[model samples]
Target: MTQKQRIDAFVSLGNFLRSDDQKLDILLDNASIKNPWYTKNNVRKQLATLSANLTPENLQNWLVGYPDVTVDQTVGIILAGNIPLVGFHDILCVLIAGFRAQIKTSSDDAGLTSFLMQELITIEPKFATYIDIVERLSGFDLIIATGSDNSSRYFEYYFGKKPHIIRKNRNSIALLTGNESAQQLHQLGFDIFDYFGLGCRSVSKILLPKGYDIAVFFEAIEEFRPISTHHKYTNNYDYNKSIYLINGDKHFDNGFLLVKEDERLASPLAVVFFEEYADLAAVTLNLENSASSIQCLVTEATIETSIPTFPLGGSQSPRLTDYADGVNVLAFLMDHATQN
Candidate 1:
């Protein structure tokens, strides 16, 4: 297929996702029914984000740097099922770059992705040859796997010899200046609580200016208290709370969330770790030291750093150009295409 045809097909797929098809609703329903973590609303929200970005203009702009893939290599993608459709962007990249994708869907998210891919095939029959949903990935030329740090080692053991992009656990964080307005803090709530803090893009920690009243931050995030009602979230919250109380550890607890001092980047679900920083410079240094473990930053402050940073609420709303782990998948694919 020509490059224009492939791009046009994706644009059509985008438009199809935007439509109010009953089948789409049923897909979301099944997704939530099968996996408690994949709530119907969360699935819908992810689909909306994908549809919004998959436009003709966005597709053309994102692909302007690369030549058409004349080679017919297949990419084997091992998707992560932490949140709804987290692997869609990788699939989109593989498809738009004119490569076949042999996908091994995460068992947690298989049904939803299969349904979406079927819809894309309906939009463009040519894609049927390009997309292969497989239980065992056998005929792939390259690899792109996402999983925990431990699992990433397993991926490297199997796929390291091949051209691959193996991703590990990475958490997002927010920096607070003690000057954010109430609206901004409320917006940061999405970064912390969205998807019940399951996605790698979800903010699990916050860096605060020294002696800042943590209470203000908690008050602004009260709107997200509904997240506490979920049984999984409540179970995590209760377990963590009991542990902290039993050990007599110092912590701040709102009705639904847990906040405490933690130097680590990753936090447990329903818990937000924070560190009081002497200055932005120290925070920058610390972030630089831990850059590999961080995915993105959610903050209003424009501190000088190479790590990707998002606005208060933009953590989960990554644009089409915002690649995960700051690795441009398209660029990698284009470079691979030239070598072969």
Candidate 2:
């Protein structure tokens, strides 16, 4: 497909997602059945955010930096199913870069991605030949895969010989100055509660100034109490709360979420780990040491640090340029195109 054709197809898809059509209802129902974590409201919110970013202008701006090339290669992608449509961006990148995508969808998220792909094929029939949804990925010039650290070891053993971008487990963190406004802190709740903290960009841990009042942070996020109502989420919350209580661990609980002072980057679902920092230097040093495990550092204060920081609530709504794991996917594909 031509550049215009590709842009038009995505724009049509964005419009379709924005419309109040019954098709979305059906898709959401199927998605929820496939994975209870994909509640209808969560799926709808995620799709709406993605659709807004799929505008023609955004697509053009994102593509303008890359060299134009006509190349045909099969790119195998192993997608993660942690959050709703988490792998859509990779598929979009592959198509826009003029490569055929052999996608192995995570069983938890296959229905929604397939539905969107069918919509795109309807908009531009040529895409039907460029896209393939497969049970297994093989015979590809290059590969991009996302999985946990354990699975990444397996991916490395299997796909290491081929040029690939194999992404392992990474979690996001927030740096709190203890001086943020109520609104900013409230928005931080979305960073935590959205997707039930399943995505790599979700803030699983936080760094706070010494002696910060933890209660104030809890109060700011009271609006998100409804998250506890989800049966699956409530089960995790209750189970974690019981473990903490039975073990005599001291942690703050607001009945919906738990805040524990732990020096860990990866937090359990229904829990947000926090650490007290003596100064900016300490936080910077800690982040530098943990660079490999951190995906995003959300904050409002300006710190002289190399870690990429997004404002509170912006982690989940990444622009097209926000490549996962800081890998320049377009450049990677374009370079392969040139070599091929």
Candidate 3:
């Protein structure tokens, strides 16, 4: 395939995933087996944005960056189920780069990914030879695995000899200047509540300016009351509320959610914690401790030269081509292909 043809194939892949508008609706509406972490609109939003990001022009530029990747190698992927269809990028990257993908789909979030993959193969039947969804993963040249901290340890031990990218549980955080507009802080709700805060990119903590009032934060989030209407989310909120209060754990009340002041990255859903900071430098040092478990940081204040910054809600809706490890995926995949 010509470089443009391969790039067009990727764009078509995204189009295929987005084309099943009705099926997408049905999956979003009823795909919840029992514990639902996503809704149709959430899935739709992700698909729409990711689709736009994989445009032919962008994919072509991506191909230019990698000048040494060989397309013949097959990559095995162990996907995470923390959020719905979270591992689509990995599949897309492998195919776009010209290698076949051996996928181990997560049982919890497999419905949509399989559907999308089926669509991709339909768009270009040749993709069938490149994509395999398997129950058990075996031999492959490279591996990309996402799992919990414990599972990541196992992945590293088992796939240690191969060229692999293994990801453990990571959380996102927000850096508050305490001067954010109500609109900006309200958008923070998307960071905290999207995908019911189950995605690795969901903001689980806020680094606050010293003596910041929790009242303002709660007021900003009040507009996002629609999120509470989801049954599973409400249950998590209420159940965790009782456990923490009964245990006398220190947490700030927000009427709809809870915030506790702490130095940790992972917090219960419908709850967020804060850590006061007098110096951004000091906060930067503290965050380094959790960097492995931290996915992205949302900030209103100027990030210190050392801290990474992404837009406030970019966590929940990452671009399709934004590969993990700060790598540009399409570039990585197409590095070895000679251009037409």
List the pairs of residues colliding in candidate 2.
Answer: none
Runs in model 3 deviating more than 4 A are 16-20, 33-35, 67-70, 305-307, 327-340
Q: If scored against the real structure, what TM-score would every candidate get?
A: 0.98, 0.98, 0.90
- Locate the minimum summed-lDDT window of 10 residues in model 1: 62-71
Per-prediction backbone clash count:
0, 0, 3
- Candidate 3, residues 1-340, lDDT tens digits: the string is 4455656776887676567667766667765643366566677777776787677777776566554343667789999887777888888777776777999988787477787778777767877788889888886878888898899899999998987778877788898877899888888988988777888788889998899988898888897788778887889889989988899998877666888876667888788877898987788778776665677788776655333467676667666545564555555445433431
**What 10-residue stretch in candidate 3 is worst by lDDT?**
331-340
The better-scoring model by TM-score among 2 and 3 is 2
Candidate 2 lDDT score relative to the true structure:
0.90
Q: Which parts of model 1 are misplaced by more than 4 Å? A: none
- Ranked by TM-score from best down, the candidates are 1, 2, 3
lDDT of 2 at 186: 95
RMSD of 1: 1.0
In model 2, the Cα lDDT at residue 245 comes to 94
